[model samples]
Target: MMSVAPSELESPETRLAPDTPWVCLVWNDPINLMSYVTYVFMQYFGYSREKAESLMWDVHTKGRAVVNTGGREQMERDATAMHEYGLWATVQKDD
Candidate 1:
């Protein structure tokens, strides 16, 4: 690989900023039970029982809930983990 001179490298101050915040949304589905949803939130994100239950209620009654918020990569990971746990999930840039 060709080596670049120090001047050719992007300086920290000139580099692009870190990625914008993103969110993982868990959608309501008939397959998973409410208790299981709460458990998934608590287990995966280490959310408190009350917080998990509140999010679960939002998913149940509102059709979806923002389960996580962070950088795009982390939000994607959260969505994938939710999928692995058999929950419907998606990631999007937070408004």
Candidate 2:
């Protein structure tokens, strides 16, 4: 019988590097108004009304919006911030 080391069990390329970028996606929801979505974007991301509204519109018309992109940790924080603001959000690798 042979045993494989833990590191050997995983593919090297599958590991997430420390500096990889991630995106925070805000998804449209029936309960949240468009204006409220814009407000959340501005309040949490410091985006101007124009930018916030643009992202909100994307979420409305496209079904989702990538509100922000940054390092994995930052994107996670942005997702958490959006959650705190009572909006639907998630983070994923920027691919």
lDDT per residue as tens, model 1, 1-95: 99999877777765666457899999999889999999999999999999999999999999999999898899899999999999999999888
Per-residue lDDT over 22-85 for candidate 2, one digit per residue giving the tens place of the 0 to 100 score = 8999998889999999888888789999999999999999999999989888888888888888
Candidate models: Cα lDDT each: 0.93, 0.89
The segments of candidate 1 whose C-alpha lies over 4 angstroms from its true place after superposition are: 1-19
Extract clashing residue pairs from model 2: none
> Cα RMSD to native, each candidate?
6.6, 8.8
Instruction: Return the top candidate by lDDT.
Output: 1
TM-score, one value per model? 0.80, 0.78
Per-prediction backbone clash count: 0, 0
**What lDDT would candidate 2 get against the real structure?**
0.89
Give the total clashing residue pairs for model 2. Answer: 0
Scanning candidate 2 in windows of ten residues, the lowest lDDT window is 10-19
